[model samples]
Target: MAKLPNGLISFGKNANCTLELCPLEASILQYQPSIPGNGAIIGLFALSMLIHIIQGVRWRSWDFMICMVIGCVDEIIGYVGRIMLHSNPFSFAAFVIQVVCITTAPVFFCSAIYVMLSRTINYLDRSLSHFNPKFFVWFFIPIDIVSLILQAAGGALSATQSGSGNKLGVRISMAGLILQVVTLVIFVALFIDYVVRYVRKSTARPLQSRMKLFLSFLFLSIVFVLVRCIYRIDELRDGYDGPLIRNEPLFMVLEAAMMVIAVFCLNVGHPGIVFDREPRNDAEMSYTYTGNTGAMLQPKLPSSSSE
Candidate 1:
């Protein structure tokens, strides 16, 4: 077995030392990564990139497509970073690439979600929501930005530090994760409320199949993201040496798999369902139905008398 450079510790127990400096006795999690897992993630992200491009062109969903494209690219880069780590655990470039890209990628996904939800609100009925559809875009996206900034800064700080770990970075990253959770929770609540209101108030109307599909998938994606965020919060609460942070299987399931599913769900339940509408006369305006029925309510117009 090869030994690391002098004065460096391979295990995370001594953070000041580079990972390559550790002895063969070091835990696998500290210096050895799963090549297959990282490879799979990279491939999946590439597939997602292609899929998003096709969907974007097919549906003309420019904003959604842009976000997904950025997200998939980030995931690809991050996983490539992981691959680099697998080859040489002491590689600082790999650490920074994985930490920064993966940490901030989801913010773009959240941006797409915000944009889609606002459009959904408009398509259904602007009056059904408490605030303007744009309000969701404006309000939540900014919060997402703040979270991204904090997480990126924290990841950079933690990655650059030597030995013993950076307490400030861990705390800041934890704060970012917690803030993300709070933001998602609030967004979900508002989204659900809007849906309920739309359903109840538009009881006479029937929902389009596309709209129903969009809603179902969108809701599932939200749940998946929330679960992932919660897992990250737990992982970070323990900081660098936390059990959750070092658990490879848990990270694979909670982080990689969760995000993959969420993105795919969005692709399947795309916002194109609502946005791909054709202009119709007033008598044929679109109005979504309430409850389990897939019926459309006819437009009501006053009678005209002829001489």
Candidate 2:
């Protein structure tokens, strides 16, 4: 069997050390417990996601349902990797699991965000907004996809190498997070612009209380996702073995907590509450729980609206 170099794993005299990186056994704390909290935190969020997904599906919030499902699954796998850490902190498989799972999870959130902009465009006066919602999908989503690919490939590449090559993985993941933050900043700004115009317009539809609840949840999801992403960016500042990067408790609060709460937000903000039973000029304006073809909504004065 080949031996690894200092600060390296999975590599020997012949293996590549540039990308494939693994935690060193010397760094493993065999004497002290390497308790990992990510599992519990992520597990709760998965539960939240499951509940919201059921609700979104029932409401036919196809976009929300898909987003919640994918994010939750990714978290579950990442936390499972953390559990493996509790068993053996230096386990290379566990490291990769956590790395890949957590790194790509946000892509799903970005996807849902992209879908939401399109729906909002259809719901309100798109002419009032600064940019077309389609731009978000056409431009930002493709960027997000690219980010996902980079982070995933980087993690895979680093996992195959030995040593602090793990730093390369962190760098790639950080790039993705930074891109997401920039895109989200633009997204929130665009939405806010529409919101202001909608509020000022004389023909604006009155928002129902139920829809408000959904909006609250959705807003919370966005905020939390942003917070988590920022935390990740900060954590990776010094690369993989940086003191800030490996702190498990911080991950529990910022990363896992943010994502779990987001799932709950979907539960309240689901389209079902906003559309079902709300009267509109056209049947198409109503949320079609029964899968009616006429359920398409058009922006107009709300009719006999109930929140």
Best by lDDT: 1
Model 1 worst lDDT run, 10 consecutive residues = 289-298
Compute the lDDT of residue 249 as modeled in candidate 2: 59
In candidate 1, how many clashes are counted? Answer: 9
Worst lDDT 10-window in candidate 2: 25-34
Each model's lDDT: 0.74, 0.65
For model 1 the TM-score comes to 0.84
**Where is model 2 more than 4 Å wrong at Cα?**
1-25, 28-36, 162-165, 275-307
Put down candidate 2 lDDT per residue, 200-305, tens digits, no spaces.
Answer: 9877666657756756676777788889888888977866545655565566678777877766666667656754544442334543223311234544444786
TM-score of model 2 vs. true structure: 0.79
Q: Write the per-residue lDDT of candidate 1 for residues 193-292, one digit (tens) a residue.
A: 9888877873424566777888898888888888888898787786776777677788899999999888989888877655664323345553433211
